[model samples]
Target: MYIDGALTDGQGRIDVINPATEDSVATVAAAGFADVERALAAARDAFPGWAATPIAERQRWMRRLRDEVIANEDDLRACVHHEMGKPWAQTEEDWDRVVASLDFYAEEIARLQDFSLPDRAGTHSHRMVWEPAGVAVAFLAWNFPLLNLAFKLGPAMAAGCPIIIRPSNETPISAYAIGELCAGIGLPRGVVQVLATETYAAADALSASTIPAVLTMIGSTETGKHVIRTGATSIKKYAMELGGNAPVLVFDDADLDLAADVVCGVKFSNAGQICVSPNRVYVQRSVLQAFTDRAVARARAARVGFDRDDDITTGPLINARAFDRIKGLVDRAVAEGATLLAGGDRPQGMNRGHFLAPTVLGDVTETMDVYRDETFGPIVSIIPFDTEDDLLRQANDCGQGGLTAYVFTRDLARAEGYAAALRYGEVQINGVKYDIDLPHGGIGYAGVGHDCSYLALHDYLVLKRITRARDTTLFESVNA
Candidate 1:
């Protein structure tokens, strides 16, 4: 655990396993009740001072951290690669996000300034001020360990709020490494703390505490609800990026190759653990066969291996449980009449790792569990549609959440209509893009707040209004 600007021991330790090898990569500190309390207290103690620090000084520290991240890029990448069994190439995205977020937020905070609001009666001058929301507690998901941490840490630090990060137990080694870097830079005590807890009791202690004014997380919707329910001890601000069942709509006139490339690219990346990964792909009936063929070709060509030099595309699931769950989904889908078009079981010649071959299923219906639930694995279910109305209805019928929707079409008018009518937060036409400068969030169960762009800063800030009565004589003199 990293607390009070130092690396310290916890009451217990959790052994982190590499999914590729199913071997213990490292053991990380696991916080107990006492440790959680100490971390909360430290954050409470440091909040005021950290918030009072000048923006320029805060920016300096952020840039310093960014520099450290850049200097130790390889080590950080290795941590993620080994800890989660993520492909070496995929780990690059994790590393890049950490660096980009720090750099982006540091400059973004400097752009913030007080806003002047006009008084309708012209009797007073009013200004809106932004201030740190106070102590923050962040819960991260394990899929993209560093990337998820970057989304929370960058904003909280830049906004001048002290944060305590509780990374998922399944992958904490990378987060622990980040703590070491913070200690090396002499970050202020309690300004940033990273710890993992094995027990739900200790983890709940963080949310249950009244010290945290903001509770943010990146995880499942049920977990988000649980946090808000437990953290209701106070009126705390919540910003969560939860589960998503993103949909992809492919029109008959669309570029089939481009669509397949994108779908396969996203589905196989990180073994399709991404929140915004395309869950249900709806292709026009006329071109259903064309789309599926391309998708299968890409899936069959995807290299699944652990060696860094192998240029691996797909990797292992986080653990045995995840592997079983994904495999069961595939088995159930096949049993229910869906045609297995490509890889479904584990890749041949690989028996030790928790790897699942990239799977593509066709003729899938909404009634199937594979289509109904968010399949956070390397599986793509293709559903065919005859008309735009039916496609729109099925696409928007996402009960899990609506984070993102993709459309591949050459018709600009049709694309614009779908983009506007789609219920998801993001609609990508022809291509997909996500970066630190764009707002990333969703509607419904997906989440409540933004994770990127200047908008994300709102989650860590409180708005204050200051008004002063204008004197009539002073106004007249100024006018003259």
Candidate 2:
């Protein structure tokens, strides 16, 4: 664990397993309650100084960390690749985002300026200034270890807030690798702390503390609720990117090949553990059969393995538990009348790892669990819709809030209408794009605040209004 400007051992250790090999890749320090307290205290102690530091100086430090990240990119990528069994090519996305986030936020923070507010009565001058909120505690999800960390760390650091990061135990090695880089770059004590704890008690200790003024996370909605409930000890700013059951709408006028490629590309990527991965794909009934055929073919073509040089597209699920859960969803969906059009079971000749082949299900109904719930796996549930109204209604009927929605249509009017109608943070028409400079967030149960772009800086910042009475005599004299 990295705490108080140093890398140190904790009371216990966690053995990190490679999901692809089911082998212990590395053993990392696990924080106890005491270690959690120490990290919180360190963040509290460092917040004032860090927040007060010059923005230019802070930018320099951010760049230094980015450079270190680039220098050791191979090692960091290896950590994520081994810890999560993510394909070597997929790990590059995680690594790229880490570098891009730091660079983007560093430049973005420099553009922030106080806003002058007009006084209606003209008696006073007012300015709204942005400042660091205070100490922050970030809880990261395991699916994209470094990418999730980058989402929180870059903005918090750029906004001048001291953050204590608690990465999921399942993927702590990559985050710990980041801590090593921070230590190497000589980041100030407590400005950034990375720790993982096996016990929920220790993890809860950080949330239950009074020091953190901001509680941010990238995880499931249930876990978000738990953090909010436990962290209610203080009124903290919450910016979470929670669970998503994203929907994809493919109209009859759409490009069937493009729709299938994108859906399969994202669905099979990282073994479909992505929050914004298309959960339910609704196709206009006229083209349902055509789209299903394309999707099934793409799923079958996906290469599933652990070989780094094999251009592998799909890798193992994070663990046995995840594998079983995904398989259960597939089995139940089939039992409930959904047709298993493509790969649905573990790939043949792969008996060791928790690997599931890229799966495609057709003739799915709204009543099925796979359609109702977020299927965080390499499975695509295709449901056919007859009308536009029915498609929109079913698309927005997600019990879990909307994060991202995809629309593939050639008609401009139809695309615009769907974009407006879809109740999601992001609505991609005919394509999907995400970057560190683009806003990524959700609504309702999905999450509360933005993760990327300049908007994300607001999560780590507080606004203070300063007003001063106008000098009446000076104004009169100047006018006279």
Q: Write down the lDDT of every candidate, Cα atoms only.
A: 0.93, 0.93
lDDT of 1 by residue, 154-230 (tens): 99999999999999999998889889999999999999999999799899999999999999999998999999999
lDDT of 2 by residue, 12-121 (tens): 89999999999999999999999999999999999989999999999999999999999998999999999999989888889999999999999999998889999999
Clashes of each: 0, 0
Worst 10 residues of 2 by lDDT: 384-393
Point out where model 2 deviates above 4 Å.
472-480
Candidate 2 positional error at 201, Å? 1.1
Give the TM-scores of the predictions, in the order they appear.
0.97, 0.97
Model 1 spans > 4 angstroms off: 472-480
- The predictions' CA RMSDs to the true structure, in order, are 2.5, 2.4
